[model samples]
Target: MKGLCTGLAAAAVFMATGCQASEPPTQVVYRFDDHRYLELKGWDCEGELWYTDTKQGVHSQIASQFYRIFTKKFVHPSERYIAIPWWGNITGGFSVSKDYGQTWETGGASMSPGENEPDGSNAPYYDDVLSFTVVNDQGFLQTKHRLYMSSKPFDDPRILPGGSGITYTASDGAVHHIKPTSSGPAWGLDYITKQGLKEDTAQFKTNYQGLPDKVPEVKGYTGWDHMRCDMGVGR
Candidate 1:
């Protein structure tokens, strides 16, 4: 419930907000006008990859170190893979681990110790940041701009083939559901919002197209080309 887009009308006016997709965003304005409740990042790991829970002050056995994170839900899809929307880049993109989180890949580059080649040159990036979740072996990428689905352990941040018709719709002061296509992932009831319908994927690309592609770098964090290791990329 923390990540659901709610109270947009109760907050500041939903003005003409904009952001940059290629670098860290400095102007992303949430429709709710309350940023404290947003679930901006999430992380998970497996035997092949490990991470540290800084709050607990214990590093995972799979890796010698871990990074700080604020997660809503961190789940394991398989023994060899983990996925998360690294800190700060919530809408920027996703960080994926094919080797049990020992390393992470994002924006088409490896965020680990020279683990894999960067492959996201053509991928659409987000910076209004959101969250990631898995259900029934399927990966879901949620951003302020859109919601996307992919096979578990996402290979890219782009929307999976046949991912469409997934949007937030509100009616009668409650939520509504439109059955998803076969290839589309089902929406979690928790994300339902009464403030607005069609918020999930409405004008997705159109909204992103208004933002800049290159995000400005965040100080003391990994650049767009690297894994947000500091945001808990590895175990």
Candidate 2:
């Protein structure tokens, strides 16, 4: 039977904020690498998010508003909450509403946010940009891979806890897994070409360890189940 990681530590990526309008509307033209796919963003008078993808072969639109878009987790020293990011104007960020989304407050820190708190490890970016804001902290717009955990994990790869990032091997019994970070939030099925087998967790090591000798780049999407393996995570 398929399983999921229990407890908050394993499923913590869930989270997000923010207003309908005051500054007209903002949008993003998500033009992919393909020849003719141009995406446009818009909001209805009632403040519902909409999009239209136009291409030579396929032209389509989202018929309704998304109640909640992208989400991330938020935790203070004491309490925890989910933050939902939405779109309004061409600009986008968190939307705050006390009576659900019946009414919205535009252009606050949650909307027009600030930069993430400076971490010395975070060197300079090409540009100083703010991604999203919640409470006092801001979560930047990241273009990283989404690592969804597997249900029947021999050991959940999402949580190694404290000390430092740890590398792992799946119970699937493969040649091995090759990835960027030893640990993050995933149970990716990387195809390593090396030959070996060890079930003991102690056998896995963390570092600049390389992936298998020859593996094609991973493309497409992934879901919470095996049926959607085409959607695998990361390279």
The prediction achieving the highest TM-score against the true structure is 1
Tell me the tens digit of each residue's lDDT in model 1 across 1-235.
5444466543433432222222221111111112111122223421122443333343332222232342433333332444444444433334444454345443312211111112322122444335454434334444455444442223212344544533434545655433333222211201211111133332232222232222222233211222222333322
The per-prediction CA RMSD against the true structure, in angstroms, equals 24.0, 22.8
**Residue range with the least summed lDDT across 10 consecutive positions in model 2:** 223-232
Q: What does the lDDT read for residue 104 in candidate 2?
A: 35
Score candidate 2 by lDDT. 0.26
The model with the greatest lDDT is 1
Give lDDT: candidate 2, residue 147: 15
For residue 22, what is the lDDT in candidate 2?
Answer: 29
TM-score of each model, paired residue for residue: 0.27, 0.19
